[model samples]
Target: MNLAGRKVLVLGLGDTGLSMAKWLARRGASVRVADTRTGPPRLAELKRSLPSVPANSGPFRDEMFADIDLVAVSPGVPLAEPSVRRALDADIEVVGDIELFAQALPERHARIIAVTGTNGKSTVTSLAGAMARAAGVDCEVAGNIGPAVLDALMRREDAGRAAGLWVLEVSSFQLETTASLAADAATVLNVTEDHLDRYRSIDDYARAKARVFSGDGIQVLNRDDPRSLAMALPGRKTSTFGLDAPRHAEDWGLLERGGEPWLAQGANALLAVREMKLAGLHNAANALAALALCRALGLPLQPLLAALREFKGLPHRVELIGEADGVRWYDDSKGTNVGSTVAALVGLARLDSKLVLIAGGDGKGQDFSPLKEAVARSAREMVLIGRDALLIEAAVAGAGVPIRRAASMDQAVALAAQAARPGDAVLLSPACASFDMFRDYRHRGEVFRLAVERVIDAPKH
Candidate 1:
């Protein structure tokens, strides 16, 4: 963390890599940035952006790993990567952007409230940050949500109001490499099968998520989740939340006796839940998780709810693009897994009879039975796309739902738009990976957005 003239070799020139290198260099560290994807478009932008940092190409060199004080890695790069292995062999420290930011924080860089899970991290993290901001506390919000941690730190430093609080959406990948990053409070929303391709097993994935509580912080766990409920951290006092808690949570979101938003916190008066423009019951869970953090931090929830009501939402995760005739179109390109897809489905609040589902993507090693059942029950028709489209189709077909396969996302979107009737919902929630045809979930989301725009904006049918 003390990069005072230390040689820091950043083993990727991706956004986080470039930003970390620039930060270290500014702090008087001798920074060398190298990327295997040297021809990547990002490389040119990185070079132009951080022209001051020493840079190189090709695989990580032995010398680069041998004597460097620390190796800051991209979350996308697996822990078993050749460069990371070399760093391990050399006994050099390997950390993530989260660690670097945590290390660089001033004595009063705000208490960190971190949220991590396979799903719901972004929503919860953003909600917590919004809550803090709503309470009139200045915050530095970053990590998996937006801006690299270092970039947010720099922005705050330049503004002179550096940090009163930090709300971060930590990822398992980021958490796996962030041994030194700690927060004042942490939440593990829920754990489910995901990323088995990179991780050793579900337990390994859960272990990485458990690392979020390592900063000796207060742990906020989801009581409704078996994985979360099963977690044990000795130094961390665990507070649990979720709709299914025996005693309704003191810091939780609940529908009022009627159709009103309310946060129930013990025998005290119920806090009205923010009237969310963002749809879904999963978002209700997200709102509760954020409210839990606010209570943990001893802040008022009113502003947070106010902020959340206005929060349009992160791009691609159940984003509403347009309405054609009376049919509403939703783009949930971020639903790369069943849990995400389920969340997307739940957030849209679409009853099964009136929903048209667009799903399919590069299949990771997860069964589609749950999504299959959800589709069969909730969806009137299904449009499948991506590499695992057939598998999803088979699963739903087994449950007796009608399905159609598309050659591409656009085709699928067009089909759904055409097939959809007014007063129905056309939802794009691919419960699989996006690597089969697109670069990432964001790319898949963008294409879904464009396709939806085309369908909605097309001359009135």
Candidate 2:
């Protein structure tokens, strides 16, 4: 952990890379930055903030790895890159921001609650953080959900604040270079096919997510996801959360009381599902996972339940934005892969009505076959857009739902509005990346929201 006078190469000058460089420099490490893009988004900020640090842009070269003591890689930069592979072959210590944060935890005196999975990481992380704060604990949520871990650490240090608890929403990409994050409580919410473009297979992606349980901390696993349940290690303390009833006293699940589902721990019902502000069964599972994680730290149940009841859920993930003609409109642009969209579809399935789904984007090489059953069961019509519209269309061709194509988000929204009936819902849950047609998922969600607003104000034709 002694970084003084050590030479470090910071790869990919994004927020993570910049944080790494600043943190290293503060520790007296010799820092240099290299990014594949000639003009990385944060390159100017880096120059102004750390003018002395050397930075190079464009394609990475072998020389960047020379004489480097450590390579702090951004999650966006794959380890498969030639330069990163070269560093590994040379026995150079390569790590991500999370690993560095883990190494610095003793100085911060903070307990970690790490959450990772293909979906619901952000929701669970935010909820856990809220639970801790509601209990009067000084907690900060970071990693993939907010500011980079190192940035949060530095801000606390400069402000002379004692770190209390850290709730992190870690991605599988961050898990790749992280080895020593011994979280006090951790959970792999669920793992489904995602980021296949970077990983060799679904197994590879799942393995990265499993790294969150590296320490002897208590593991909170998803009982519904076999992939998540498989991560439990021998002799490790574990808890489980699912939509079904809990069998163990410490596990979290649901129970039926008065013919309605209630969130429960073991056989004891805690809160009715209708009491929660967040929509969908998936969010109920997320709330259970958050409760399990917070409860593992021995946080009081009352505040945790209070946080869950007050939680509005995150934007761009099954957020209900507008209602027009009795057709509800949802923006789930964060459904950037097959599993998320599948969850959204299954979570919102109604017996009285169906969904008019707006989906399609980069697709990210996911097998859209899993979506077929969900679509057939939930959707009345489909409006596709983005680069892989045809691929998605072909995959769900026999879902017994009408599929239409649109050139833009506006067109997609119009088509969905047209297809939806008074009781039906219109959802923008593109099961693919937004880079093909939009800057990012938030941008895509914003566009969808604006388009929905337009429909809501169109004189109700």
Candidate 2 per-residue C-alpha lDDT over 89-185 given as tens digits, one digit per residue, 9 for 90 to 100: 8899999999999998887678999999999999999999999999889999999997999999999999999779999999999999999999999
User: Candidate 2: where are CA atoms >4 Å away?
Assistant: none
What is the lDDT, from 0 to 100, of the residue 47 in candidate 2? 93
> For candidate 1, lDDT tens digit of each residue in 184-279?
888889888788889888898998998888767777888777898788677666677765422644535354545654555553435444457666
Please list the C-alpha lDDT of all candidates, in the order they appear.
0.77, 0.93
Worst 10 residues of 1 by lDDT: 244-253
Model 1 TM-score relative to the real fold: 0.91
Candidate 2 has an lDDT of 0.93
When summed lDDT is taken over every stretch of 10 residues in candidate 2, the lowest stretch is 345-354
Candidate 2's TM-score? 0.99
